[model samples]
Structures are given as C-alpha cells and as structure tokens.
Target: MWIHKSRNPNQNFKRGGCMFSIFLWEEKDVQRGLFKMTCFSAVEPKQLGVILKDMQRIKDGYAWFLDGCVFCIQPFQNQSRYSLKGYRIFFNTSIETGMYLYDITLGLLGGQISGIECVIKCPSKKSSDWISGLRSDTSFQMTDPRGLFNKNGCGIIVVNDTVILQMRNRNKLKVYEALKKIDSIREELLSSVEYDLFSCSKEAG
Candidate 1:
C-alpha cells in the first residue's frame, strides 16, 4: 500500500471541479510515466458535474476515481497497443484523515459500477513482483517481466485486484473511513503475498 500526503492539500488537491483542461504530453518518457501521476488542477464543482453528465452520453470508455496526493507506481507494456485497449476517465476525490492519508479508486463502466483494480511498481525490498495472490474474484490483468528496475531501488511491482470502494460519503468522517478501508485492503494484499522479488533473486544467485 502506497500512501501520499500532500504538503498543502488545498493548493495541490482539486476534486470534481470544472474548467476543462486537457494536458498533452510534450516529452516522450515523461508522457509514458504520466498516468502514474494525477495532474488535474482546481475547477468549479458545477462545471465538473457538467463534464461528467456529458461523459455519460458516450457508450464506451472506463470511469474511475483519482484521489489526489496518492498514487501507485507500476510497469506498463502492451503487446497490442493499437488494438481495442480500454480507455479510462478518472475523477479526483480526496479523503483526508489525521493519522492516515491516501486515495481510493472507484471504477464504472457503461454507466454501471464495476470493480476496482490497481497495478503498481514498488521496490523489490518493499514489495514482491508476484501479484497473483492479490487476485480478487473478478477478472484482472497483470504483466511483470523478469528484469525491470527504476533509478530508485524500488522495483517489486504490486497490484490490488480486490477492494471495491462505496461512493457513500455523508461527511468528512465517512470519507476518512472509506480511505482507511482502501489502504487497509492494500496492506493486506502486500502482506499476504509472502515473498519478495529479491528473495527469489537471492536464491537464484
């Protein structure tokens, strides 16, 4: 489970606001890593709602939540990139807590709620590249090849195929609970894996 805390929540965090902005990638490698980062800035809440309503008219594409200040690092490689790869649209929702902080991803498809899944790369020492253990009852996809590492030593590659988030938030307290639940489920999956990528590497040596 990766938890990101914002230094200034209001400045950096914007949830479901309007003033539509589309960011295009200018740099090659930077664009490849852009999905792991959420860069949407503040906008008007009503404007955000209008955009969502318009989106519902579209028959295709995926919908998901993008919690500010939290993200998962993961590997990306597709054998068939030009094919019918799914398109995803995400919204930001910040669930702040005093002790713990993170964001939860809620997925929707064809105007109906669907399951949530996240695949991210972590340090071999901090997490294992093996993610079959995190599989939920629902169908999911993962790809962790043999040799891959970032500049940082963190390169294990973890994923959460379980843990669905309910969009029921009456107040700040409820939001906090929802965020905590999401984080806890991630922790459970990481702990249950029981093996780190480096451990296998050490044995191979």
Candidate 2:
C-alpha cells in the first residue's frame, strides 16, 4: 500500500498529461514533531554514485527503472478540473537480496550486422538513463561477474515494496502495457490514487 507524500503542489512539474511517476515513502521529521514531505529529484548518472552512497530512504522518490525485463512507472498529477493522481505496480515477495539486470538496444541487435558502423547504438538515448541505474545496481550484486551488466544481460528485478515516484519514461508501449496489467482489476488505478493524494494533501496542511 504505497502512499502519497507531496506538499506545496506548485513545485511539481507541469501537468501536461505526459507526466508519470513511481516514488517511495519520503518523510521529513522536524524536531520529532511536525514532519514535512518533499518529493525527491532525479540524480544524473554522474550523481547516481552519490545517491547509492546515501542509505537514506530510497522509496522516498525514485523516477523509474529500465533495463531489459525490469521496469517501473513514475507518478504524476492530473489536470482535469483540478485533480492529482499517480500509479504503482506491486511486485511479489520472491525478489531476493540483489536486483535485476537486462539489456535493451535500439534496433535489432545480437545478430549478423550487414552495416558494421551503421548498426544500432548499444543503448538508445531515451531509456539509457534509467537502464543505466539498473545496470549500476547490478554492479553491487554479491554474485558472479561483478561488472557483467553490459549487453545480452540477465536477471529481471521483479520484486520490491510499493514505491511512489514521478513517471519520467515516455515509452508508450511499455507504460501502457505495464499500467494496464497491474490496474486491470481496478480498471483505473489513478482514480484511487487521486483520492489518496487528495487525502494526503489535506493531512499535510
């Protein structure tokens, strides 16, 4: 059961319908009294090392994760007659101590390439960042091949506690399919997410 933790709605990005997120519990306790909640921001690859260095609450606010098989969606606000909502996909508890790993190239890869130089770039620009995060996490795994997250990858990170984050990835096919699969029973998960968000905002005030 993931919850919303947004305060001061104005700081959020535009609600232009292209926004999404998947975050975690990010709370700020002030003098052990009033707690403030501010969403976390993205850390560039150069800054990813710093994020991992801090063992602070990660579920606080993570953008997304993309590799090959493992992927996550970010949460965002809605703009229809004043509305705020987000989504989440709960993973089974079978996930082990380590994370998942995968490889996603642009065009057809790992096959005979007629044009050697003109072949597809190993990692596409769009999904390169998030996927890079997954690759980095795998690097810290306590298993074989410490730095073998490069192509033709393996191990799908399929489990984690419900995390709340802002949707950043624009892969329509992946986003639509993932959302549909998880919220099938509820049909529209955002509707419920919106209600939760509204409640959280009131509580914050």
Best by lDDT: 1
- What TM-score would every model get versus the actual structure? 0.27, 0.17
lDDT of each: 0.27, 0.24
Provide the lDDT at 166 for model 1: 26
Q: How does model 1 fare in lDDT? A: 0.27
Name the regions of candidate 1 deviating beyond 4 angstroms.
1-131, 135-173, 192-194
The sequence of per-residue lDDT tens digits that candidate 2 reaches over residues 59-116 is 3232222221112222223323333222222121112201121011111111111110
- Give the Cα RMSD of candidate 2: 21.3
Count clashes in each candidate, considering only residues at least 3 apart in sequence or on different chains: 7, 23
Candidate achieving the largest TM-score? 1
Give the Cα error of residue 109 in candidate 2, in Å: 1.3
lDDT of 1 by residue, 1-205 (tens): 3233322222221111311122211222111112221211122223433444422211122122123322221111222334322222222222232112112221121111121222222333222323333333122333243222221112223322112222222222243343345444445444544345456778999
